[model samples]
Target chain A: MKKFTCIVCPISCSLAVQAEGGGDITVTGSKCDRGKAYAKDEYLAPKRVITTTVKIDGADIALLPVIGTAPVPKELLRTCLRHLYGIKVTAPVRMGDVIERDILGSGVDIVAARSAVIKKG
Target chain B: MREITADIAVVGGGPAGMSAALRACGLGAKTVLIERDAALGGILNQCVHDGFGLLRFKKQMSGSQYAQQFADAVYESSASVMTETTVLKLIPGECGSKAQSRQGLYTTGEKTGGALIRAGAVILAMGCRERPRQQAGIVGSRPAGVLTAGAVQKYINVEGYLPGRKAVILGSGDIGLIMARRMTLEGIDVAGVYEIMPSPGGLRRNVAQCLDDYDIPLRLSSTVTEVHGKKRVEGVTVADVDAARHPIPGTEVFVPCDLLVLSVGLIPENELSRDAGIEMDPVTGGPVLDNFMMASVPGFFAAGNVSAVFDLVDYVSDTGEAAAEGACRFLGGEALPEYVTVRAGDDVSFVLPGKIRRDLPSSALYMRVKRTIENAVLEILADGKPVYEKKHPIVTPPEMVTARFHESAGSGVPDAGGLTVRILGD
Candidate 1:
């Protein structure tokens, strides 16, 4: 048996999960369908979106914030952030511009979360 | 000093200010937005983490993304934006001298010198600031690495630098929890998070996702008592706190860390509002507002953190839109009606829009619970008679709950001299 808190909404339902072997699983204490689905996914293959900053050159700011286009495997978050930190981009980056495609083969693209304009001379 | 005139002048350029400016401008009012920062996004530029805009935009995104959406819209709109400008004073215009009681907004630009913006109405949207070390009651040495969670966020996300390799977070607020994950992801070693209260101060989702996911220990009823080392933070003394939140003398343990991040609490930035003589709510630490977000003074409106410290930015933007509408109406020569007082009853901390007028078809009231309640029923009574009620699975102090009183619910609420918002738990 495992316990989890549903993070899908503000309700924050506490879900109790019972699993038999690796096949049968039962989830209880969810008040809504979304919470139930979240519990199932959380118990199975947990995924999370990554939001981090990467180095940027010739921009007004030293760093540009980025977000993963899709939720990747939870364990791959560090690897994705490390890869993003190692890479640098020039100024004039627009929001939603892809910075890295298929990051760590997680099928998640790292896109610029905010625009970085060129520094004024 | 240079002089500029507009129909409405909005203070602050964060989510609330931007939304208010956009709404006021969209309604064909000449609006001027004044921001203190070089950019219009304000603190959201440092808040790179996701989980924002779920209610406003209907899409969960990063704070920067949420802010940029409004920034882009403001830029595209006809509203005039003045960045890197500081508001010196808010001078109320003489009554009957100008239509709708105009105001003089004295401001100083970064490079363009001083200016006085004369507008018919003003919107106060300056956001809140995090409480610092002194306010948190920690007896510590002055150390270099001691910084607020927001400062650390700025250092890592905006400046691209880590504050320290090992860190100890003092509060379990949402920012502290998020920073624990953020610092850990940035290769910093988070020793643990020590919270003074038995329960966490932030939302449950943050405790699960930020602390639990990272294997970070959250020690409840524990606090950082003292700081050690000089120049930089070398360690901190963690102590077990009693029910009264006093440090137990014999239970002190020293935790070695180079960084101490403080996420104690947030107080609404209301210096301008306070100095302008607007009545404030002692509980909320913001201005006392009517249903339309109007403060005590005529033609002066308050919204966002300046009105109250909202749990979500969506509510902040919501109040911004409402305040803008009120300002527009004031400019259109509409008089404010009499407002009935709304009191916070049993198990309730505080309620916003402390008063409401009878004429509005609907009004939204935001409040927080004094403590945790299971199977909670929120009841709104009009002069001791129940008029509106809502049921919630659970209610906690960390999360703000909202209830709306619509005309469809009942009609006697508007005329009631007093209303009480309370939580009934079974």
Candidate 2:
């Protein structure tokens, strides 16, 4: 049995999961249904949303913040960030503008968090 | 001199100030918000992290996205905002005098020649500042590479500059934990995060997501004893501390790093409040306020980090609304009743709103613990008589707890000597 803290809410329920080799698991100490689902997903396939900044050209600010539209595999987070660091976008981009699609074959698009306008000289 | 008059004046344009201004305008009071920065978002602009607005918005959002929601509301409201304008001085208003009505003076903009604002009420929402290396008592040669966690956030997230290839962070607070993850993402190697206390200072979720997820080690009962760089930070010396937090000799270990980030703590910005003759709570390091959020000065109010360091932005916004309502009531000539002093007792670090009104409706008392405890019961006593008690599985100093009390819960007990909140082991 492995112990984990459910991050679905501020309650932070401590869950104990016992997993068998044949794709079966038992969860204990969850106060709600969300905690159970969180434990199952965490044990089977953990995922997390990646938020980071990317360099921008021709903008008032030097970097623009971006985030993956969907949760990506936890193991591929570093790969996704490395790919993001290599790419640079231009200004006049909208908040939801897509910077990259299907990042690292994770089927998630990285989108801008805020609009950046070109600085007038 | 140019004079701008409004019913209510809000200082600072961060989450607290924006919410206060919006709530004041919603209460039908002409409100004016003054911001020193060029924009209204304040520090939220560079906070590009997620997990904000979880409680209030019911969904996780980025700091800028959460701030933009409030900023857009303020722009659509009737409140007038003055950006790039700094409030230089706050002159107390006349109170209980027949000659002139109560109106406070707000001097803004230029130092010598600036606009004067007279309002019926003033709300101090000026946020807190991070404790730097000097404040943390880290003896070292002054260098260019020493930076606060907030500064590094701005440099990387806003300016797109890699401060250094290797970094050593002192203090395991939220900012330090988040920055460790951020630096790791940018290809910077974080040596470790050292905390003097046995327990981490940041939230458990942050420890899990930011540190544990990134395979970063958290060194507890340890601290940075010295910085080892002259021109720029070349390294830092880490040492273990005894129970008394005294440095344990001969245990010093030196690690090489170019950047040293400090996330020690935050001090509430209360210079204006102190200058305005408001009584302050030594424990909170903020103004002593009553249940209505009114300071000792009759027409002056305070909220947000200016009132006390808060862990959550949602609570800051809540205080803003509460202070706004208090200001509205003051403007409507509703006199507050006598107050009952509230004190912190055993295992309790401090409590916000040092006093409570006799006729208050329902109020929440926010407090922190001095140390971590398990299976504890938090009790609220009135004159040594228990009025409220609640059980908790675990309590830590990093997270602030709130205890609610109704009007009939003896919070307004007449002739009550005092009210105290304490934590007792179960």
Q: Rate the local accuracy (lDDT) of all candidates.
A: 0.89, 0.85
Task: Tell me how many residue pairs clash in candidate 1.
Answer: 0
**Clashes by residue pair, model 2:** none
The Cα RMSD of model 2 versus the native structure comes to 2.6
**Tens-digit lDDT string for candidate 2 (B1-426):** 778778899999999999999999999999999988766877788888888887798877787776777888998999999987888778777532421235555565653247777888999999998997888887657977889999999888887788999999899888899899999988899999999989888888788878877889999999888888789889988999999998899999999999999999888998888888888888888888987788988888888888888888888888999899999988888767888888998999998888988777777788999987878899988878888889987788888888886658764473456678999986
Candidate 2 lDDT over residue span A1-121, tens digit each: 8878787765677889998889899999898899999989888899988788888899877788887788998899888888888999988877779999989888999988777789779
Q: Which docking class does model 1 fall in?
A: high
What TM-score number comes out for model 2? 0.93
Clashing pairs in 1: none
